[model samples]
Target chain A: MFASRPVVHPMEVAAAPANPAQQQQPQGVLMKDLPGMPGTPSGLALRVTQFLLAAVSLAVMSSTSDFASVTAFCYLIAAAILQCVWSLSVAIVDIYALLVKRCLRNRRLVAFFAIGDLIACGVIFSGACAAAGITVLIAQDLLMCSENHCSSFQTAVSMAFMCSFSLAPSFVLNFWSTAFAYRVVAAG
Target chain B: MFASRPVVHPMEVAAAPANPAQQQQPQGVLMKDLPGMPGTPSGLALRVTQFLLAAVSLAVMSSTSDFASVTAFCYLIAAAILQCVWSLSVAIVDIYALLVKRCLRNRRLVAFFAIGDLIACGVIFSGACAAAGITVLIAQDLLMCSENHCSSFQTAVSMAFMCSFSLAPSFVLNFWSTAFAYRVVAAG
Candidate 1:
């Protein structure tokens, strides 16, 4: 009885054309077509913005003579540097993809982007929160916010927050795109 | 000329049995069969461990007489509380799945787990880092580490770190499983 039916490999099944519904709609579009997705113009813009914000954050914090004296501020500097490097590299990739008009929706590439963004999110979040914690202490007069470059520190921390905020959508979209690409090959 | 071939649906193509290579391999297994994956015994064990660690972290931190005195410590407390609640709830779900011998590989469930885990990771990581920053300052004698349950606070921070570490594998597994389950539905 089974032999009467055509043998269908699962891999081929992923691209099968029998279902009219499947044929009518595009497949594997979990927000991949969004403007901010990787390889798109908006993606490049977002990456550039992230890079600029992180760079400005690091630069602003470093300008303060006494930032190094606090462990939280130092951590923020490290996080900002990481964010800057990551965003710049990805922006370069985005620009290249745009120039060539190539799709950056490959599973491996999406996975890489997702993981990198996740790490960046965690690191920057911690740095920003820690800096904010210390800033609160300073504000409460527990320490000397007035004797040092407190305003600059605050500005740098806010920049980090902005950079992280921009990263949030990218992170979710890439993760969703990756999930949509999961057409696993069948086993014998 | 185009009508010569059979019309196949993409959904069926995902499960097609024609490809010998695909038939020889298991489909949709991005580490989903591992013990630590959801709906498995090891997954339950990991969740229990996470819950215990987070609970202990919160308990220890709150035990200190002056933890509320510092904003960083207060943040740590909040993070620990969030972790405890999240892990405990998931552990209950894991247990129920195990009791019924049911698979928890549904797309929505996996997505929920992934997002929750990501948020927990960020929160706890920031909390731990902030607490550690304060600890460093105290150790350097910039603050009074010798007074008001300093050692207890340190222990609590360590517990939070451990809880986050335990969550790392679960986070990766759930994300992978969610990706593997991403078979887009055919449109009507």
Candidate 2:
């Protein structure tokens, strides 16, 4: 489809006019647009989901360290760890924001979230695709799925994708808000 | 830092108020934000870069077809091909846009661009990381660097990253514009 008319969907709900925060709330809006804003329940939940997914992915893949048998496995570890740490830190920020009732939404903060989430999304996507590729090898060409830690590899790959998917909404949300902040600038 | 003030950067140049596209330009802005906005020098350049990079990545990786030894290699093919097709069609669109001077920007189109660019970026990232992981394995653990297609593998991985990098600016530009367009939605 070349050009479809605009429709108000779930994603656009954040930009709805009745959102009073929009008035004196650029910062708050940015914070709320975050997947894991500390003050917002929805955002925190998204962050938790990402953390849990990354952790699960790591646990499943690491269930058998045979990942070291391939560099992709090592990358899975790196991606999972990065997701974990990122989710954890954001979660902490959420808590801190909640405690202070402070808004974390601002152009710079949204930009930070956008960049961080995007990079992690990239890593997770790469890990998942690579692991999936290798998993296919173990199952088909290698015919080692039955004997080796193939199941673990599969599980890990699945979780890596799950982690990526989980992080996606936040990425989208942060970027959407950031775009708004970005458009308001006047250049020389 | 949770709350940093915004800093005007190069990316914001396109969105500056002085740009004629700002007024009666929401649709045009959306159109211009596209990577393949026909006739436009910058837009065409971005599309060409993406196409060339993807093609090069595929050519280098497919040189030996030893990649078939690993599923990750297969995935790389898939990613490369998708990129190739996507870029080609968009390139055609750029040509069309140039000829017609027609507006292709709209919420749905921008949304499509956001989702498509984001997904492709994810796939490219995944492909590169996976291949790189395997490349490391071949060079170090397998001690096959001197004998096998190590150089080829390295070249492919580099090209894949190069493709990814080339795609980044367009992706960022599209999202930035999408966010701007997105902000105009009616509030609740």
DockQ: which candidate is best? 1
lDDT (10s digit) by residue, model 1, range A99-143:
998878776788799989989977887788778777766765377
- Taking all chains together, the TM-score of candidate 1 against the true structure is 0.78
Native contacts retained, all candidates in order: 0.42, 0.45
Please list the residue runs of candidate 1 whose C-alpha ends up more than 4 Å from where it truly belongs after superposition: A1-34, A141-143, A182-188, B1-34, B141-144, B148-150, B186-188
Please give, as one word, the docking class of candidate 1: acceptable
Per-model TM values vs. the true structure: 0.78, 0.77
Q: Encode model 1's per-residue lDDT on B73-151: one tens digit a residue.
A: 9889899889988988888888898899888877578779988998898788778877877776676537776665768
Superposed by TM-score, candidate 1 places the C-alpha of residue A168 at a distance from the truth, in angstroms, of 2.7
Interface RMSD of each: 7.2, 15.9
**Each prediction's RMSD to truth:** 6.1, 9.3
The DockQ-derived docking category for candidate 2 is acceptable
